[model samples]
Target: MSAPSRIVPLLAEGVLAVEGTAAPSLSAGAAQPLPAPGRYLVEPLPEAPLTVTLDERSVTIRPGGWSGELGPSRGGRVTGRARDDLDPGRDVTVLALATGGVVARATARAADGGRFTLDLPATVARAPYRTRLTIGIAGSDHVLGRVDAGRPPRAWGPAPEAPRLRIKISTPNLREAPLWGDSHFAASLAAAFERLGRPVGVDCMDAWYGRTAPEDAVLVIRGRQPVQLDPGKINLMWLISHPDRVEDAEYAQYDRVFVASDIYAAHLKDRGLPHVEVLHQATDAVLFGGVAPPETRRSAPVFVGNSRREYRTMVKWCVEQGVPLDLYGGGWDGVLPPGYLRAPSVANRDLPALYAAHGLLLNDHWDSMRDNGFLSNRLFDGSATGTPILTDPVAGLEAVFGDTIATASEPEAFAEIIRSCLDDPTPFLARAARAREIVLGAHTFDHRAATLAAAVDRIAAG
Candidate 1:
């Protein structure tokens, strides 16, 4: 063999081409923001050599450079047909997933014809959420196919020529806070509507002064920053948080008002704003839809949220009780004891893994929200991750989540619940699975998009 061809074959398939004196100060993998964590296809050799620092520490890799690919699936039912000359009745376990979380698992057994089908649970198979398929063959030392966790492609059709009333989701979050502000909510909602073949855009508060077009309708997301009503436009509002900041003037000219809390919706309607309705916040199904296997997940409690300028109740309880916690958020500098805080903030993309790693999620709502029924979006996001959640009491919590969630008004109950989870997590894991079904099936941005889209279509017709 030639010297170049016999160079030990470090990496398979010529995937990586790195040569340098250890490229310094560069961090790859999940640690940094750039170069997202996923498989990248190398098309051609570059003229200039790439510089990268390979970690000296040992790492695990598949023996044959595993490849995982999700086959075409519809309604969570993944089917396959092949003429295998190997063995009959040798079933391959198929795992259907959304993002990285396993939503459904099925077995595809090879019959005489070598044909097989994987029927993923319809409860978790919605097109709005991305889906991946994993096939685990028996008697394999290495995970053969690992690319199902990667991405797929889809193209959109051309837009209509009519003067359509597109939507503008206006929020107080700035252009800079893509991963950490209200813009995440706005952007997800816009994408949800876009998937339904509607034109939707997101504009931060600073850009909303004189930028609206006559063909645009506004959907204001009310949080800490309250936006004023636009009288000349078809304005709809979703009052999700910061109930105390809501003002009559801010929602006066809004064509429709969707409150997060049924109680708050009534409160607004009683004040002569009869256009108000209840519409709770939802989760990003594809992004926050997966859970790690039980054996692989950690059993410690995790909390991811800011202090909101005050010591959150569940966090204080965890600290006082000496619970081993993975806390990630901001505004926790002087409040938390030394070594208790894990990170100032967890990146938006990293939240699903964070939720999957921990056994339990610690959630809370502000005083106004808890009392007035304005459920925090955290509840929805955590539930979607399939993490058993222990949240502070909120009005109608039972009605919405049923018994899937554990509510603790006092520290003692909180401790009891955590202990129970640590001791026997089977019941909690079941609850988490049920909660994930609820979120993915009904409480996703796709569900909310239908309601919001109908409202805009009505306005356009009028």
Candidate 2:
């Protein structure tokens, strides 16, 4: 007997099969109606690589060679495919320009899938700097663009004076492991401001305590306990961790407040704090993308984080369950049965490869953050490596990650999920790809830098 005629959906509605071929019927759920019967080539769309043009000169973006150049004006037009594997309807691309102490950025989303344009502020200081340009869906590893101006542009009359937006960021010393996150976060924010043509200074909390900074500067503090800074400047408290630790009375001291999680913002507002904005943790996409995976990744699950009670519980459960887990973080000594941690601690820069070198990564949040939906920076870090991660479920996390991440409510579920993922790596790989696209699309440090620049501009205006 002849096999029943099978049907497959076409790329667009109203596409008709070729004459004599089976007329594939559209499902009731098909979005569009059938069009007049005619020949149609129905297939998946081809890859749409970026086509960057500078001053009417076409530049090819490749992995090893220099591609494009920007004038002192730092304005250009970019045309590329609007859709990617993640979202076929996506039409936007984010652009970031980073130089010595400066970052200029803009977004260009093509409406007609023809071309999009981006123009940076002409007043930005002219200098040679590395460019990290990323277009979502085009793939996250596009960091080869560079701007090589032989020298500064010729002076054209007297240049205009720049904006007065000097910022001084104070955080704990870099040597301290517990506070390294705060230090890295503050440094990244400072670099972003510098890219925006703002003079920024960062110091250990103790160095700036009870001391004055540059006149008319803005001071930003990132720590558990607020430290005294130059009282003369407007201080902004960047609560990176332990939102609940910030007392109600502490809210009045700073000109503005920034939290790392949107849910934390609501919690603080509920606690009567005002002028709070959510500045989610962002990964340095270029750095993470540069990390090369090891030739042999361990078959067992791996996790890279400090030894906390909750994290220890999950690790211990893995050991008891006969699953070999490699741990990387400080203070794990004597915590696990012998042979658990491959190394005492791994550098933050090495985290991406470490993540990529494993089939599965485990994550748990700080108790306060977990309860309040404050996603950890690890979430972004692991995702950037395109590695499957299993984290504890948080309320509203689906909005941020959708089905790209897996969550286990309890230790047993975590173990069970890990086993299932190990048995079939297909689903995990698929989710990792989706999550990476999301991270590159909206959660990179460039995105956070733009958000911070806008927020500072608004606050400075007043």
TM for every model, in the order presented, reads: 0.62, 0.60
lDDT of 2 by residue, 1-462 (tens): 643332221121122222223343322222221222322322222123222222233322212211122223234333333222244344534343222212333333434542344443334323243232222212222221333222232222321433344433334344673346666665656676667676566666445433455434454545533443333344566666666655554565566787877787887788787888877777777766456655655678887767854446678778877777888777877667788888877776677877898889888777777877778887887888888899887755777889889988766787888888887877997898888888878888778767665665555455
Best by lDDT: 1
Q: What residue runs in model 2 are displaced by over 4 Å at the alpha carbon?
A: 1-179, 210-215, 219-221, 229-232, 292-296, 308-311
> How much lDDT does each candidate structure score?
0.62, 0.56
Output the TM-score of candidate 1: 0.62
Model 2 TM-score (2 dp) = 0.60
lDDT of 1 at 290: 58
Tens-place lDDT digits, model 1, residues 267-315: 8889887678889989988788854544556768998888889888888
Kindly report which residue pairs in candidate 1 clash with one another: 68-146, 68-147, 68-148, 101-290, 101-291, 329-344
